[model samples]
Target: MSERENEDRKIPASDPVIRLTRYAQVPILAGLSVAMVLFLVTFFVDIYDAIQSFEFLDRKKTILLILNLLDMVFIANLVIMVATNTYNTFRLKALVQGDDYIQQGEKAYRRMKHRIVSTIIIISSIHVLSELLEFSQTTPLQVAALLGFHLVLLATYVVTNVFKSSD
Candidate 1:
């Protein structure tokens, strides 16, 4: 063993990612948690539509379905957001070391990257599903444009965070 390996090791408080996250996690989680509450409210939005039914609404069925899909997206996004962000910002080493799937943190960032990618996927799925319903009368060109944006976001998030699957 090398003599240098015997020295005490310390991670500096100057690391920008660590320092920023220490202070930022609370506000970020608080805001996201509130957003989750709003999303939960959206889930129950269809009660009035349900009571009135076809008498008042022309396409109440379609609206209800879309709202349900939106609710699922929001819930999924919230779960991923809370899970991944908490793991990355606070319980980083514990997350990495405690998971059997983590391979001893050899690829320390891999777990984080994968979680981030999954979060992006959930968010993009929500956006697409919501757009499909609200933009029901949209032109083909507009739908295509929105789809292109989703694809770009998906690709960028995947490419940047995750190791190439093809590789």
Candidate 2:
């Protein structure tokens, strides 16, 4: 190929779009870090409440604490995935092996989505279970709504997996 043709194919070293994309990760990282802190703080608070009141750590309270901790874990996982994936995506080609890095980014995205759906399903199930266990207080309508939400989440997870497998 001619030198000019090769030059045309190359991205400029000072390309604004690439620079901006890379720069954007700074704020994203900062924001997610703050959220991570809050998640951790709240998770600890839930644990403290459960343990400090050990005498009253009945099944309902125990389940709620466990659910809150699980939710926090899922949130933390999501934040980490977003932060790393964002950094990976905007990184300069010179810093990473080209096609392989890009493929890994795609795989990360797929895994993130699967985790998100699974997290929602688990959280939803916890909510439903809590409601069901409170047999005397939970209305039938509330029970139905919670069950429906959980079913939708399950369906979404299944359909997403099927499509991903097909690909």
Candidate 3:
């Protein structure tokens, strides 16, 4: 093998720079966990408020509240996915090494990207729905713009998946 290739294969786990980066990821993971908890708390608070106000009697208000809760769920799931994947990529790499690790990592990456996009689309749709529910307060232009943005996101997801499948 070439000298450069041999050097490239050497593990940098002992390197200070590598160690620092790995350590840095700890706080990031912690912050993500905190954020996920906060989202959960917010979700339950919304549910309690809805119950207290007897929003279920009003179909429109109930639907809006449900949509808001769904949006929070999607967002929390996104945050959890990111945190888990980040932990697996960084922390698991040193413990697991092989073709399987590389393959699994790649698959996880693709799935993560797909799910993130899907979550964003769902959240945006919820926002659009909530706005539509309050049509009296929403202008035609605002509705049109929101709808256009949602379509763009949906189209982008479809086109990316098409290309990914082709590959």
Which candidate order results from sorting by lDDT in descending order?
3, 2, 1
Cα deviation of 90, candidate 1, in Å:
1.1
Q: Give candidate 2's TM-score.
A: 0.76
TM-score of 1: 0.56
Superposed by TM-score, candidate 3 places the C-alpha of residue 41 at a distance from the truth, in angstroms, of 2.0
Of the two candidates 2 and 3, the one with more favorable lDDT, higher being better, is: 3
Worst 10 residues of 3 by lDDT: 6-15
Q: Which candidate, 2 or 3, has the higher TM-score?
A: 3
What is the per-residue lDDT of model 3 for residues 1-167, given as tens digits with 9 covering 90 to 100? 99987666654336778668977999999988888888888889999988998987899888888889888888888888888889888966777555656787888888889899998999999999899989999999999999999999999999998666542
CA lDDT, candidate 1, residue 76: 58
Alpha-carbon lDDT of model 1? 0.60
Query: How do the residues 87-124 of candidate 2 rate in per-residue lDDT, one tens digit apiece?
Result: 66666344655466567767777876777777677767
The best candidate in terms of lDDT? 3
Candidate 1, residues 63-92, lDDT tens digits: the string is: 646656565675656565555656554555
| Candidate 2 residue pairs in clash (backbone atoms < 3 Å) | none
Candidate order by decreasing TM-score: 3, 2, 1
163: Cα error in model 2, Å? 4.0
Q: Give the lowest summed-lDDT range of ten residues in model 1.
A: 5-14
Off by over 4 Å in 2: 2-14, 92-104, 135-137, 165-167
